[model samples]
Target: MADNEQDHEHTPLLQDQDNNDNEQHNHHDQTSHRNVVENIRNLIENEIPNGHHLNSSSTPKRVHALLPRLFTLINSLVDCSNVEDEVVTDEVVEYLCSLGQEVVYGLLRCIESMVAEGQRDVGRKRLLDRRAEITQVAAAAVTKAFVDKDRMGTYCHVLSRPYYAVGEERNTAENAIEIAIRVHATDFIADIEVQRCVQALWTGLILQVEEDESRIRFVEYGGLRRSRRGLLDWFDIGRLNVPKYQNNMKIALFIFFLAMYTFVVNNQSPNPNIIEWLMYVFVCGYIFEEFRLIFEGGTAFFLGSIWHWVNIISYSMFMVSFSFRFTASYILTDKSKIVQYNDIAYDLQALLAVFLWVKTLSLLDGNQYFGTMVMVLQKMLKDGIMFFWLLAWVFIGFLQSFFALQKAETKDFNAAFSLLVRGFLQDPDWELAEVLDNKYGFWVFALYLFLTSIILLNLLIALFNSSYTNITDSSEKEYLALFTFKVFSYLKSPDQFPYAAPFNLIEVFFVIPFTPILSKENYKSLNRVVMGILFWIPVLTIAYGEQKRYEELTGTNDDDDIQGGRRRYRHLTLDDISVEDLFMIEDVDENAAAVSGETAIQIANGEEGAVVDASFTGWKSNGPVNETFADFQRRRVKENEARAKAAAAAARAEEASSSSDEDERADAAAAAAAVASSTSAGPAMSEALVQTLLASIARMEERQKEMETLLKQLNVPTAED
Candidate 1:
């Protein structure tokens, strides 16, 4: 039993010694591991510092320190380990990767400090130098650590190209977006939304590229591709399109003119029935848009886009309506089975062609081919008389044909009968039809003769003469007298300002005088009769009024009063009148209404000096029987008239001079007086005059107070009254 107990105690002591040995080995192993960790930490800290100062010298030190850590990170991530055990290799890689991350973090903090200091110093020669240095070091380190250098270079190259996004101008954001788009770096980008931004930029860039190409092509070519081509090119080249509204208006105006010409000429066929005028009216709504800006002075631009579709539809409707009218009318009316007015249709088609030309105006620049074609007829037919004559002849032909057809129908004439009658009318001699056909020929030849001799030849001469005489006149006067009154009618008046010319006595009086006569509807000799009446009415009325007035006052029935009107008028001109005693009209005697002679001129001239003569007096002493009386009478009349005339003339001169203020003389006088006053005044003398004036003012005030008290008793307001 003792031996067993001793054995148990010895075993326990032996077990405790083994446990202590194991504890010591474990402690030694832990200490060695701690030493290894510290060595590794020291090595990492020596290579990568927490802070770095910004300088040329600091960069090399940073690069050298960062390289080892970068290599470690790469190798760790690559799992470059010689261990055959898969688990051990993974564990080693993870440990090394963690270490490398710490080193990388420390190095990055150092670089950040360096960059901050560099920015603060402004010690670099240029910003680019600072940026280049910082970027080069950072890029080199990042490249060694993680980024593939080849891919980054390609990315940078793409970023250099300017690309526009929302705005038309290419900018930095757009270039960055372009790089993202080209590289398909959507997944790599920090935010997914950036891809949409990149796409938008790409779309804008594509449009720009197309616009630039278009401009280059246009310059290479001789003609413009479109009217807005220049603008689009500018937009593509990153320039703003100016007066965009006006440009659009010009295009619309051209379109309007084309539409008008087509609508007027192309639809004139005597259709089976013309399209309802309502359809044309409705169609005019579209034509309205084309001209809306014209009435507004062609200043709107984008307004065209708002109604572009409407304009096109309206114009198309008009074209269709007219086309149907021409086709139906010609088919139904043709008796010969051949078109009667084929030439007319051809002319209509030619005019219709202008609409296409006008439409093309918007697409082209530089050359104005489309606009020219649309307006070509305006230049050719600008002569008003020529156009009027042509229109008149067309009207005459249409009227005669229509009347003839009606007459034939009344006589129960068929096509066969008409043909037979036509044959019978083809006689060689003494045939009325032959004479009418050969001589009249639709009245065209007669129209030509009348138009050339009367309208064109005479009016052209008159227009040139008037224009030459008034070229430098006031613009308002020229337009009012030459254009509105002479060529057209009273329609242009509403456009002029109320103060503008032709707001004159002549226009007011003469405009209404002959309107009723001119508007009379007489044929054959209408104009000749009208013009003759216009020329003579005023003259005859004035002469008759004078003659009757003279007869009434004198109670003399004398043929001499009526016969010698012109001779009396010349002798009693205004120049013969003396100025002092102005003559004016008085009440006319009712009994003298039938009297033969009176001249307003004699009254005016006689007012100067002459009085009624009781007995006959000679014209001069050399010719008459009562020589002494005539000489005395003439001397007295002449002396009184001379004095009166001088006084009246002086008054007239004063009135005329005062009518318009002369600014030059007034300004000169004012300037001279101002200089004199300034030079004459001085400080001390001015004060003395002021004091004397004040003393006199004080005395006047005292007297004024006494006068006011006295006036109060009389209830009068006055200075001293």
Candidate 2:
């Protein structure tokens, strides 16, 4: 009976456990089935556009239409947190590949709409809202697909499509550029894939601009005539006003006019006239513009560019030349001083011409053939500064030594330094040595020659060679980066009027006043219409008068019939360039090796090596003190225990000292109180109390000494003791 009762009790508990397990299993199955149904519903909702419905029978027939929608849905679902997201993404990508051109076209259209919408107020707000909730994730996904190597054919086709209808009537190159600029301005600009796509598009555009024969045409009479559409249209005042390019053109024109002025001033007598006044106006305008750029950028920007300093120096010389010439011609009364000032002015003008030519090197910095050499030269110049710094100290040492030893023979410090420099050049004047007649002078001169002429010169040559070689190896990449920066700088420039001096004045007088009153689109149209009207004056004049002059000078119509003669003077562009032709650095590993080599060289030269922490590569932890996390933890624990023990011992000693001090003070106070009370009572009471207090005081002192001894034994000293 007992065995039966025990079995029955255990049976009920087992049954209860079985029932709980069944409930859990059923709940799990229901959740899994519900998840499947929800996934299918989401897939259908996302893949099919609104107001569209499809049954299983129609799904097969609509697969073509569904493919793009499916890709778009997959792209949107990229940020969704689910186990099937990656699998779905891969499926969508594969499906896109199978669909080919249709899918690519759909993606491009999607991107275009997105970018166009993003540029508008209401559309931007909508996109911002969607982005806040991580909706509409298709842009980055589409960009990724477009940049793939296998999809290069598709990318090229889309870019070469020639028509982008962003509410524009005519299809033009500007429309294409607008699309590219919009895409570039988006969040995907940082992606390497997006960068490549944009770069390729820019390259194609640049090539088109360069090879565009529409800018020049043969005239019926004979001489070449500039076409209605010319290269300047890309940077026209009424078009995308890129200030950097406009400034470059203005500077070039200023230089030309300045040269003409210099020639005229030198060739003719200084007389006030219309041409002279025009020259003055141009000069003043150029100077004002230069200063405006300088002040706006501030000192750091000015000092950072070597070209800016050159500009400053050239401008200063020109100003001086102008002042001297003006004073000599108009203000001065003395004929001799006038002649003297004129001569000074001529010399200053000549020096300014040289600096001007040097400044033109900056304009050629984008040329592929010449740009590398210019960059190498710049690098060499920078490295040469340090070499000169070391040489300066050596030269000073020689100067001091020679001055001290040859003071009697040399006239001054300048004379002695000149002599030392001459010696370094290996052509020392033995007469100076003979005049000095000092043995130490000869020794010092010999040492200086050995240090500077042999050692320092060789070291400088090696440094220059190394820097040149390194720069040359990476010159293509550097030049490409510089060229891209120049292009982007022009594109991003905020200046609305990108015209040269007199023309800029027209814009300031007419265009600027109307800007606030009109919408940007309306303003651009009006500005273009006005600028076109103004431009025709020059165009007609050039076609008639200049062509006639050219015909007369050539004496033959055949020679003047050539088109594109003016094309050679325009800016450099990457004509006929392939996607693969873009230059990029490919030697990242070599950079680390170069750094190691530099460090070794510094050590070899007995110079202090720069402190470089190896933690950048986790090498710092690989040294003699390499320890695991467990080992570190154990060490920290032991240190913490030692600190705790020290603190506890100090606390105990303090407590003992404090207790002993309190006891001594209490005993002394008790004795003093007893004596005071007895004195207040009477003479008989005072005599008895005094005897008792003295005994008690002696006992307290004895006890205090004993406590002090005990404290000493315990290594815990009290203040009184």
Candidate 3:
């Protein structure tokens, strides 16, 4: 009935086309739709043959008349949108089956006529017979497309919402899920609300039926999304972010032993038996670990516990032992261990171990106390009582070897006194020549003590005293100064190489204090100190040598002159220059103006109150030289306020831009869709054809309703109570 209505409305257009064709050709085209229809009617009246090949022009109009009827049938099969009742939805699905193969094949033929050869296979009727299966696939594709669209919508929502714009928390997950449920329900699920509730019930039922263990381990529909690779796999060797170079205990211990040997050689002390023993022990430990790895393959527990701890123990032992002996010897001998090339070498080893311990402690975070304790020990070894012991050893070694030796040999007190008197009274050739000789340095031991007490003693005292001061303050500046001194000292004599070898376990005992502080939260502040110390040591060592060379060249003998020489050379000093002079000398104002001229000018004029741009203009400002307390405070306050305002403005602008983008996106999304009807006009209908198509659709729906009513009546029982 709907097709008949559409055919009646479109017949005039076919008649007009036939007339036009006839006028152009100057002949009546019987192949035209009007001509063909008339001819077919005439043939029926006159009893003519039935096998007539209709031309393309006439067939299309005839097909057009049949298309609306066929479109209604196909549309019903997969039309689940806005369905509120299951009975009606079922009736629609059942009514679609009544079309049978004949109508389906005809529809396929029409589609084939319009579509290209590549699409003809897809237009086949074999799959259309199982129209339900085809509908399911189409629904899945449509659902996936809608889900992607919904995700985009949610992203826009979160980006555009006023709360999000103002820095309130964004609702990303909630928005995504809400959109997914809404678009799918209205477009795909028949009796949408009821079907969705049923799906939820089915899911809950399945979950309840599952065993506890299975449920726990099963792929949950709802859970935090994780990468396919398990957590442990990421930590495996050769994976992402693993430590590239391991701190080898064997190499560190060798370096430690080398340092000890150098220390003994430089100080001209007792047997280096301790250093030899350390080397032997470290080699043994390495051999043992190598054998274990060879036989058992490496395990995590072994690596983390036994291997790492053993190295720490060895390093701590070396440091503690060295500290005890060196401190005692320096005190007794009255020699400056700080000046010795070998002592520097040994400390370098300890320093490396300390640095390694610091790094490991960082990995453990704040939870590990053992690592922190080790760091404290390292500090004590580096800057604590070692200098006192070194002083004691320097003084005591001379007394024990010389005065005590003479006292023991001299049975007469007068002879002992005379022996001491003879030492100074002796000729320069007799005393100096003997002291310079290989074996008679027993007398010269007194000279070593005297010179050390006066010269080397002060240096040792200053070195340790300054280190202690820095350790107490633990400031970046102090650490830098200490490191600078160490570097200068080392460069003055390269034989005292820092960390020349790998580290040992015992030295790590002194590195534990750093573990608690080397966390990511604390590292930024602490790292500056550590890096300053590390870099400053080398630089200061060079500076110290240069200063010493300058003093030597200038022939300076005053202790104050020596101290002044040690300081870094600069063109200007605070007391010697004014704010304006400093500005002139360094061209500070010019540089600041070049970087940000407007901001610099405002700051200089004090008109804009030092307002800075968002990109760190305030932070980069050059304030008054040697600024007074009030001036510094005022400048700082103004700069901070300007920076804060700039940052706030930038944040507001970013939010505004984001909201505008979202508004544009939402507009585009709204424009993309047209007003949808209870039933679509199918893929074959267009706006130019809407009025004729709607008349067809309305009649088809009425016919479907009548059929459903008739079918229900037929199915009803005839027997009554």
Best by lDDT: 2
Residue-wise C-alpha lDDT for candidate 1, range 1-721, written one tens digit per residue: 2443343332312233533434456776545433432322322232443311111211223334544554433323324223222322332332222222122233233333434564676753243233323322332233222212121121222221232223232221223322322222222222222222222222111111212322100001101111121221212111111122123334544565556555645555444223344334434543553444344222222132223433465466456646645565545555443354444444544654555554454334313343233223222334444555764564455336433544333433243234323332332122422233445433533453355556655775665445444333333322222211111111111111111121122223444355466553332134333323432343233334433433443344455546546523222643343211111111133113423334323322332112221111101111122223224345445433433433343343334333323343234333432332232223222222222222332334345567668889899866434
**Residue-by-residue lDDT tens digits, candidate 2, 147-196:** 34222332333222233223433212222223333343233332344445
**Which sections of candidate 3 miss by over 4 Å?**
1-226, 229-236, 244-368, 384-386, 393-721
lDDT of 3 by residue, 6-30 (tens): 4434442223453454455533443
TM-score of 3: 0.17
Please estimate how well model 2 matches the true structure, expressed as its whole-model Cα lDDT: 0.47
The clash tally of candidate 2 reads: 0
**TM-score (C-alpha, index-matched) for candidate 2:** 0.44
- How high is the CA lDDT of each candidate model? 0.32, 0.47, 0.34
Clashes per candidate, residues 3 or more apart or on different chains: 14, 0, 63
Q: Which order, best to worst by TM-score? A: 2, 1, 3
How do these models rank on lDDT, best leading?
Answer: 2, 3, 1
Overall local distance difference test of candidate 3: 0.34
